[model samples]
Target chain A: MNQEIRDGLRAAVPVIISAAPFGVLFGALAVDNGLSVFEAVTMSATVFAGASQMVGIELFGQSIAPWLIVFSVFAVNFRHVLYSAAIGRRMVSFTPLQKGLSFFLLTDPQFAIAEARYEAGHRLTFRWYATSGLALYVFWIAETWLGALFGRLLPDSHALGLDFLLTIYFLGLVMSFRKRALWLPVVLASSVASIIAFNVVGSPWHVSLGALAGILVAAAAPLEGVREDEANEGRADA
Target chain B: MSDGTTLLVILGAALATFATRAGGHLVLSRFRSIHPRVEAGLNAVPAAVLTTIVAPAAFNGGVAELGALAVAALASLRFGMTTLFAAGAVTLIGLRALGL
Candidate 1:
């Protein structure tokens, strides 16, 4: 293997390990939410954002407006905007088309590892990026297919807590960001607001309403003595 | 929903997500800097949005589920993603098996 390809695959190993469960879980959960195996695989292949895909499948089960589901997916994935902005600067030699393709694979860990690479004084090569990204892409699709097939064979989803696994998964995702600024207040506000919204407004609305409450609190919080760019880096392994 | 609709929603979401991934370079890069508040809001997006997904589930869960979440949260403070997730899964399954 070429050096760039080798390095890229190496960089992706940890990410592949961490993300493996979610890939399979999303597949099973997608089927649980009524997606066909093909659709589940299609989602893994195309959308490729784990959390947003989960949000998409969750909403798919609720009979919410399709646009709203798409919107929720968009909202969940909005963080990629920052990632793109931050990582774009490091892709100095990438052609416009290469940059477009590169951005498509820009998941959380992709961004972090690439940024880490850049910060460590290496040139971010297209070969390196493509190797890592495609390795993840192939595994994601394969796992989704496996999970879908496995999900089909399961007799009782409830007994095994398949319905609640995503909840635990989501909780794990939330906890991963505990080191970020305003993490506690943001979580508390969103949690309280979502619970209230779940009671008053209902299922789908809580996601948006609760998220808005938390974002507003964080944005409006006093910035006195706080470093401006402190929020920029993290594992973001999800 | 029809398969067609499901496919459509998935495609739409992919497009929107792609725009975000590409948009920052196309649009936001033109700006020299981002407002601190805007940055903070963006920073909060993952935790805030993910919390909404988790909180409602925790609120509606039975004791086993809640215990699992509590254990997961504590484990998160000291552990990596896989360990914390496994800890929660084990706790949840064990509690539910004991008829929690």
Candidate 2:
């Protein structure tokens, strides 16, 4: 391939590696969730958001209202809006089509990779962004396909705790918060709100409710000298 | 849901996701500055969402579930993300088998 694709692929290594199992797990679970192979793979291919897709698939299994599923997906993905602004301004020369593709492929790993590279002072290239994004984009779809085909081979994924892997991953994510004082309160507040939302209010709304609580608390908290760049770092999912 | 609705659901989600990704880039491509508070709020989303997923399960889940969560957390911190999964499922199952 060309230099851009290679560079992009190289940069995507950690993301691809980390995401592979999760992708596979998602695929297997999609099957378990009663999605046909076509539907499962298609969702991964098109929707291209892992966590939200998980939410969508779960709601789909429960046969929740489609709009609620869509809403939950939106709620999970709303973070991308903030992600786009952080990375988009850097792609000043990108055409409208590129803009469309950039967001189509906008995801946590690609965003995280690009954010890390740019923050380190490497000049951000549309090529690098596009290539790396595409690398992840394709791998996610392919692996999901593999997962679905082989999903039945695995024992009950939930019984095996496959579902909790992402949650575990996220818990590890909390350790990344170097601002010790801040993260504790944010987590505590989020936990309380999430539990309340999970129990009293409704289903899956807990995820969004908890997250919003964290955001609101974080916004009002004293994060002196906190810059726009710092915000980009923590925006990726586990 | 019918086949059409299922398709619509997927399509709707894809569209909504694409909008979020593209919308911000389209709007912000014209600018150089972002408000620090807005930035901070965005930054907090990931962690907050993560806590939403982890806290509930770890706190409210059964003995096997709780044991699995503890294993996942300790393993992840010690071995790192490269270890690839929560490893809690097996642990949780094992704990249950042991009558924990």
- Which predicted model would earn the best DockQ? 1
Candidate 2 per-residue lDDT over residues A77-113, each given as its tens digit: 8877766766775666678788778878889767656
Pairs that collide in candidate 1 are none
| Alpha-carbon shift of residue A34 in model 2 (angstroms) | 7.6
Cα lDDT of model 1 by residue, A18-116, tens digit: 577678788999999999999999998999888789889988999799999988888778767767766787787999999999999998667766754
Residue A51 alpha-carbon offset, candidate 1, angstroms: 7.1
What is the alpha-carbon RMSD of candidate 1 to the true structure?
6.6
Where is the poorest 10-residue window by lDDT in model 2 chain A?
A229-238
Off by over 4 Å in 2: A1-36, A51-76, A85-99, A108-132, A147-151, A179-181, A226-238, B1-9, B25-32, B63-80, B83-100
Per-candidate TM-score against the hidden true structure: 0.67, 0.70
Error of 1 at A182 (Å): 2.2
Give lDDT for model 2.
0.74
Per-prediction DockQ: 0.50, 0.45
- Measured over the true interface residues after superposition, the C-alpha RMSD of each candidate is 6.4, 5.7
